[model samples]
Structure formats: structure tokens, C-alpha cells
Target: MTILNGLKILDFCSLLPGPLATMMFADLGAEVIHIESNRRVDLMRIMPPYDEEKESYIHQHLNRSKKSLQLNLKSEEGIEIVKKLVKDYDIIIEGFRPGVMKRLGIDYDTLREINPRLIYCAITGYGQTGPYATRPGHDNNYLSVGGVLNHSRLKDKKPVAMGIQIADIAGGTMHAAIGILAAALHREKSGEGKFIDVSMTDAMFAMNALYGTQYLGSGRPPQPEEEILNGGTFYDYYRTKDGRYFSVGSLEPQFRKLLCEALEIPELIDSTFNDSSYTQQRFKEAVTDAFCTKTFDQWLEIFNEDFHGCVEPVLTFDEACNHPQIQARNMLVDVKKSDGSTQRQIGTALKISGVEPTYQYVGAKMGAHTEEILKTYGYNQKEIEKLKANGVLI
Candidate 1:
């Protein structure tokens, strides 16, 4: 059976963090109802690289298996509708600045009075209570303030922007999902709900898992090219003869032995264990030179043949998506479009044994499910038309 078969979620999030979190819950079989706004329209709807269906590719991928209700939050009728939804929907995911929900008169304190089982999650850049709580920030700003961007860079060079939204996805999406699930579990036990205040910056700061502890204990700040896994040792990326890169993470002695043997450099195998800076530099240089002797495809073939060290070519996104492992694991799925055709999209990342993820439909247009949802909540056709005519329902 599905894990969250009967769980209901009212999603009031946009962009990445909170939307992706609710998408995960929807993947787990929860009934996710998305609250959309046509007046303020989410930018994801207009981002570049739209599909043939006119919706953005990312919007389709992140918002699959959910229902959308477009409503004007500025109207009292819309606020009353949201309060009515709170009576039955147990979870609410919001991505706004600290006091936006409170100003809307639908904060956790207000909603919990409606249903004590409500699990409200607020995803923000900073946090609900901090000096920078209400500050306008984005993923990069959060990563910088949380100390990740400082150390995740070239030794003396400027920090480059990451290819993905690490703070938005890892900090906000992942942490919000975990917090909501944990609150659901707690509510199951105690018959009470919770208010989860998720700060992307705070999550990033807490993600300084290993190096942060070292700094706290040793009183020395972590710098780029100093940590073992952060380009200090031979555990790094090497360029191939064909300009492609290979990740070399043979940190353990056994793996290092395999790597050195594969490169036909037995002399450097023992030197790999040495902690001296000169020895490490020499080892890194030799490994770099050895990797330069082969092309990207040649290295992959050689590694596949017999080499078992932690070395592999860095595949591009398309290449990784089409790889045999990813294909075998069913990472790509065919989501149903409105016209009964299917569009290939990334499937749910979760891998529960018996619970299969259902992709009902692609992301809906603005207010696509407004009348359908309102009908279920006791609003008849006349009332729904009146609300729509009065600019409450978009």
C-alpha cells in the first residue's frame, strides 16, 4: 500500500524549495492540492526552455501528480476558502518571508485553531526569528551566508556559481520534507501537530557537518584546498586527453592500490598514504599526468574492464540520464499529458519496495482545478461563478 494514502496537503509554495517538498509528498501518494495565483503567477511558469505543451520543463517535472487551484489571496472570500480547506487538509507548505503568512491571517497559530492536526511548514531564506529573517535573499545568498560558498571554491580563485540550487534543494527542499514527515509522525503519536520554520541559510550552516565540527574542536577555519575531500589530497578531478574530466576518489588504501596499479604506477601506491604536502603534490601530479595519457572513452573502457578503484568519467546531464544504471533503475518515466500522450520526465527519487509512485497528470494551468475543488468543499455552481465573477477565483 502507499505510505501516505490518506494524507492531504495544501501547497501554497512556488519556485523550488516548498514545491519540490510537496511534490515528494505527492509522490508518496498524498493528496496534494496546490494553491496558485494568476495575479502574481509563479515565475517557473515563464522560465526558459518550455516544452511543446507550452509549460516550462521544470514546472512540469516538479509539479506532476498534483491539483492546482487559482485564487486571489487578496480577497476575503479566498482567505475564507483557504480556512475551509484547513479543516480537512492536514499539512500546509508555504515559501514566503517570515511574516507574510501572518499578515495574510493564515499563519500556523491561526490555522492550528481550525484543526489542531495541521502541520504548517514555512520555507524562508533566513528563518522566522533572526537578524536577517525578513531580508530578501536567494539560493546563492543563503549559501554564501552559511559558509558553504567560502570553502567550496578554488584555492585562491573566486567562487563560481553552482550548476544546481544546492541551498534551495538540499537545504530547503530536503529539510522541509524531512521536517514535515517528522511532524506527521509526531502528530500520529501525540495527536498534535507542529509549526516547522525552515531556513535555507540555517540548513546550509548546519550542513557544514564534518568541517564545522573540526573547526569547533580545533579552532581553525576550513579553507578551500585544505580539507582532504576538498582538493587537499589526491582525491580530486583530473582532466583526460580528450578534455573530459574523471573523478578520482580512491581515498582508502585498498582503493588507492587499485588505482595506482591500474595506472601502472606501483611506486606511487605506497606514497599515497603519506600525509606530507610534498608527497601529496607529487602523487596528485603523477595521477594527473597518467589520466592525461588516455581519452575519456578509453578511461571508461579500462575502468569497466578490470579497474575497481573509485574512478569514473564525469558524465554530462544527458549522458548520466541515458546511462545504463539510471535506465535500469527506472529514473526516467513517462508522465501522462492531458491529451493521453506521454512526456518523458524524471520519476520520483524514492524507492519504496511495494509503494509505486503514481503520475496522474502534468502541472495544471492557473486555476485549472478551482471549480472542481470548490465543489467538493460545499460551493455550488452559482456560488463558484459568483466568486469567479468577483475576482476571488482566477
Candidate 2:
């Protein structure tokens, strides 16, 4: 059996974080019913980069292995319907502002009255009670407040923006998933549910454990390019002759010595341990000059031929998508749509020993299972039709 075979989830979230958390559960075999609004469609459904048949690629990828139910939560009848359905679902995840769910009368306090065992998760940019709880922000803002962007700069340059939404995925999505699962485990013993407040800013702060610890213990905050891991040492990226980038991470002494030997710069071997800024600058310049002499492919060949350092060519998105190691790890999967067409997607990263995750299909259309879900909640055909006529369901 799958890991979460009998679990049920009601996901009332849009964009990235909450949907991604519940999508992970759906991949692990949970029955995830995505509660969307007929009045306001999900933003992802209209984002760029359509599929071959002009379907929303974001929707297809993020909402795979889940069902959709479009209902207007503003209507009283719609809120009643959700109240009835919450009695049966094990988890509820929402990504609205701090007081929005309470205003809609569907907050954790209200839902726990109907089903005390409901695991309610709230994902927001800030937490529920902080001064910035109600503030509007995104991934970059959270990263800025959490000290990630500050240490991410290159010497005197502006803080570099990351290609991926690190705060949304790593901070919000990952932490929410972990919190919900932990609450589920606790519920198994206590026979009670819990509320999880996942703040993207808070999660980023938690993930900065290493830097935080250093600062707290030494009473000194890490500056840009001052720490070894943060481009302070030779463990950094260098440009090749072909304008491509290669990464070198010879952090240990033996590996640094091996790397220096391979580069035929034995004089720089002892400089790796010197904390002098001048020595570091000279070593980095020498390494940079050496790398500029070879093309990326040539450097890759040399590294593959028994180089003892942790060096590799920086891969593009397409290259990483088609990489042999990633493919071997089952990081890519194909899901067939209702139209009998298949689309490629990034698969689940989790790999349990005996339980294999399943990708049954791509995302369904908006309101694709609305009538069916209503029927399961004891609404007859005529009542469902009446609700649809009243703009409760569409």
C-alpha cells in the first residue's frame, strides 16, 4: 500500500507553497480535493509556458494526482457545503492572509468545531501573530528579511536574485509538508488535530541555521564573500573559455591539495589554509586564470578523469532535466491527460524503500469533479443542479 493511502485533504491554496505541500501528499497516495473558486480562477491556470496542446504547464505539473472542485466560497451555501465536507477530510491547507479565512467563517477554530481531528495548516508570507503577519510579500522579500539575500551578494555587487523561488518551495512548501506530517503522527497517538502556522520568512530563518549559529556564537554576522562557503574561498564558480561556468568545491585540505596538483599549481596548495585575504585573492585569481584557458567541456573531461576535487560543470535547465543521474533517480515522470496525451513533469523526490509513489494523471479541468464531490457529500442531482444555478458551484 502507499504511504498515505487513506488520508484525505482539502486544499484551498493557490500559486506555489500550499498547493505544492498537498501535491506531495497526493503523490504519496492521499485523496487531495483542491477547493478552487469559480469566481476567481487560480492564477497558475493562465500563467505562461503552455504545453504542446496549449494547456497550462504550471497547472498540469502542480496539480497532478489530485481532484478539483470549483465553488464560490463567498456564498453561504458554498460555505455550508465546505463545512459538511470538512467532517470527512483529515487535512485542510489554506494560503490566504491572516484574517481572511476567519472572515470567511472557515478558519481552524470554526472547522475544528465540526471535526476536531482536522489538521489545519496556514501558509503565509509572515506568521500569524507577528507585526508583519498581514503584510504583502513574496519569495524575494522573505529571503531579504531572513538574511539569505544579504549573504548572497558578490563582494560589492547587488544581492543576486535566485532563479528558483527558494522561499516558496524550501521555506513554505517543505516546512508545511513537514509540519502537517508531524501533526498527523501526533494525532495518531492523541486522537486530536493540530494547527500549523507556516511562515515563509520564519522557514527561511530556520533554514539559515548554519549562519545563524555562527553569528550567535561568535557575535559577528557573516558578510558577503566573507565566509568560506559563500564565495569567500576557492570553493566558488569560475568562468571557462567558452563563457560557461564550472563549480569547484575542494573544501577539505586533501581535496584542495589534489585540486592544486591537478592544476599544476603546487605553490598554491599551502595558500588554501591561509586565512590572509591577500593569499585568498591571489589563489582565486590564479584558479580563475587557469579555468579561463580551458573550455567547459575540456574541464569536464579533465575532472571526469580521476580529479579528486568536487568539481563539475554548471548545467543549464535543459541539461539538468535530461541528465543521466537525475533520470536514473526517477526524478522525471510522464502523466497522461484525459485527452490521451502525455506530459513530462518533475516527479516526487521522496523514495521510500518498499512503497512506490504513483502519478496517475495530469491535472483535471476546473470544476472537473465538482458534481461528483457534491454527490459524495450527500447532495442529490437536483440539489447539485440548484446549487449550480445559484452560482454556488460552476
CA RMSD of each candidate after superposition: 1.1, 1.3
What's the count of clashing pairs in each model shown?
0, 0
Cα-based lDDT at residue 307, candidate 2: 70
Window of ten residues with lowest summed lDDT in model 2? 304-313
Residue-wise lDDT of candidate 2 within 37-75, one digit each (tens)?
757778888888887667699998889988999898988
**127 Cα displacement, candidate 1 (Å):** 0.5
Error of 1 at 266 (Å): 0.9
Model 1 misplaced regions, further than 4 Å: none
How much is the lDDT of residue 70 in candidate 2?
89
Q: What TM-score does candidate 1 reach?
A: 0.98
TM-score for candidate 2, residues paired by index: 0.97
lDDT of 1 by residue, 238-335 (tens): 99999999999999999999999988889988875457998999899899999999999988888883677899889999999988889989999998
Model 2 stretches with alpha carbons more than 4 Å out: 305-308
TM-score of each: 0.98, 0.97
